[model samples]
Target chain A: MPREDVEDLELELLLEALYRHYGYDFREYARASIKRRMWRRMMEEGLATLSGLQERVLHDPACMERLLLDLSINVTSMFRDPTFYRAVRDKIVPLLRTYPFIRIWNPGCSTGEETYSLAILLREEGLESRARIYATDINAAVLQQAKEGIFPLDRMQEFTHNYLRYGGRCSFSDYYKVYGDRARFDPSLLEHAVFAQHNLVSDASFNEFNLIVCRNVMIYFDRALQDKVHDLFYRSLVRSGVLALGHKESIRFTSHADAYEELDRQEKLYRRVL
Target chain B: MVVGGSWGGLDALGQLVALLEEGCSLALAVALHRAADSPEGAMVSYLQSRCPLPVAEAEDKDAIQPGRVYLAPADYHLLVEPGRFALSIDAPVHHSRPSIDVLFETAADAYEEASGAVILTGANDDGCRGIRHMKRRGGVTMVQDPCTAVRREMPDAAIATGAVDKVLPLDQIAAVLNGLGRA
Candidate 1:
């Protein structure tokens, strides 16, 4: 076969093997991006080719697990995009306070950074005691990291800066214990959390949420996937609930735009409308 | 060469990778520098359609080949081993797995005298040390022109090391890489 044809075949075979063996369907993703990521995996894994990498991933459950980790993006920090978090604090928290029992979802909670950020905000607003936060991600590895709640001490100054920018009222250091090179967050901050594995792409909404924070995660999806996620978030929210997206992401083009009102246009914060 | 970037990185990298020839002689690796936990691949796919090279996510222990583009998976640090790619659970470097530093350093070690490193648009100084290492090891070092970078910090930091061989815009970086690959 021509090298050109061979490469094309390899790409298809690799995608098929991934779906058949791992049950992770990325077949519909934007191919160039998927191809880029898979090829990088090929180089990193030292397989010399995508076909070989696909073969290993097909047969080795551990390799499949690792591949899953590789495919998911996890860049997150507590109170990431401070201005966005502040918007939630100022506009959404007061509304959430009215509820007797509130359920909040931080989908794609990546290492629990945003989850804890929301927890801190809720605590400061006197709502932590009544709220239950479900922090979910498809990657088990990051979920484990989230459970540990340990961050590098060197980053505290920056995290402190972000915390303050988000209207934090206390010393950011008050949230964690400095342990050598690591800072372990106060477990009490997570008292209301139930961390779980959830594939936003493949899974349905499991429970209703008064506020859903899916920041910065949806920009990777194609229109179909984005729409599906929008529907899921809409289904998950109670009436007059809130949905927060990443700064670059918006519901403006989605079919569900009319379902939610923009609470903060700049922050991409929206409130569900009946 | 799989190119991965996030935030200001997308446009910068898009400009860089858009330069590969239809039958280029070198493979590309990318550490998208994104959240470590979101499972979605579209950016590389979009690039592949326009570039002459085939693109895909980098899997652990995958082999390198010319004329192909690779992207690092979300959570894993995409690294270059002796002649292969490997993934690690080691903590995030510069708060990112599939870090630019991790990919460049490991690629420098593996390719040693044969490697080339480019630091494009980024908000942080993640790729500077790696680019420096690549330079010390005889790899060609390049940075996107900080003046033109959407996020200047990354390219600026790389240039500050004084190890970079060229500081070109996105389009120019593509031309340089194509020239080197052809040579």
Candidate 2:
């Protein structure tokens, strides 16, 4: 067989080992990004091939954890897409306020930047007192970091700029206090929030929610996996509940296209009308 | 097939995209750096207005179609798999979301020798490594002649690697694309 095919076979075996041993089913993740991350882990460990990297990861739990971090991409920032948040503030927040008690599920909430963004939005709109946010991810490490409410100080400038554009009412600096090179965000923002580990690939929905904010996460899953998760989200949402995805994602291609009506197509917010 | 451009890329890419006739019998994946908030549908509308082919902003897990142009959506990396396109929110490469390197490299891995990639006018060298990898995988590779490019650094960088199979001007590059290998 050709060398590239051999490399592909090695990656498949490694993914199998990762699943069989760790209960982490990355087999359905987008192949391009997953392969790139595996290659990065291999190079960082000074291994020349995927097979060698697989051996090390299978034997060392710590090595697997490192690979896990690489696999679960954390390329996020607070209110990264300011316009999306602006739309949420202008359109979705009013709907959220109607509920006597709001329940939001933020799956794949890596490191919780957007979750905190949502929390702050709630507090500003006077809905924080009755809102319950369940911020969950497949990786416990990110959840731990999310609970800490700290972020890199360098990213603050960009976050601040985004906050201003998203119509933040107060000074962006009011939320966090600096500690050395990092900024520890106000823990009170998460006062009604709960952080936990929940794998979207394997776990069942534990509770119905009034809103679901799963942005940029499904882009990493294959179509079949994306459909499965969308079904989960559909079932997890209450009647006329809101679902917000990343700007680029759409439900039109999936089986659930008719199951919901468009709330704001440009902003990728949908309302379940069926 | 895959094509990449940046900085003065709108005209360069639009010209190339316009060359993909309705019966071109080839799929084209394109990447160009664009702002996260580039006024929804404006870019696709502009590109579509210039070309006879159907122009689209790529979505995750989209099936690759022949005689169509797929533009990398803003703030996402467009990657190709066997017969489908995948999107990623992975960190930008070369400070560029929708990095040409990410698109071309994945295209090379997915299609191997069946792939054909063109590196056009760009300010940065994002497509160099990807085009190099394509050439090594026996895929056809080409670069727009630096002198003919609005931004020469990108094509010059690819030429410096000695992996480009051909270096041509804009008109000739479009001609070569018109005469695609039908991969």
Q: Which one wins on TM-score?
A: 2
Off by over 4 Å in 1: A1-9, B1-183
TM-score of chain B of 2: 0.95
DockQ value of candidate 2: 0.70
- What are the lDDT scores of the predictions, listed in order? 0.77, 0.89
Poorest 10 consecutive residues by lDDT, candidate 1 chain B:
B1-10
DockQ for each model: 0.05, 0.70
Tens-place lDDT per residue, model 1, B20-112, is 777778878887687533434676666676667788776544568787888776656667755566554345777877688878876776676
- Cα RMSD (Å) between model 2 and the true structure? 1.6
Candidate 2, after superposition: displacement of residue B11 in Å? 2.3
Residue-wise C-alpha lDDT for candidate 1, range A86-186, written one tens digit per residue:
78878888898889999999888878888988899889889999999999988889889898999988878767877987779888888999889999999
> Across residues A142-260, which tens digit of lDDT does each residue of candidate 2 receive?
88989998888999998998899888998999999999999999999999999989999999999989999999999888888999999999999999999999877889888888989
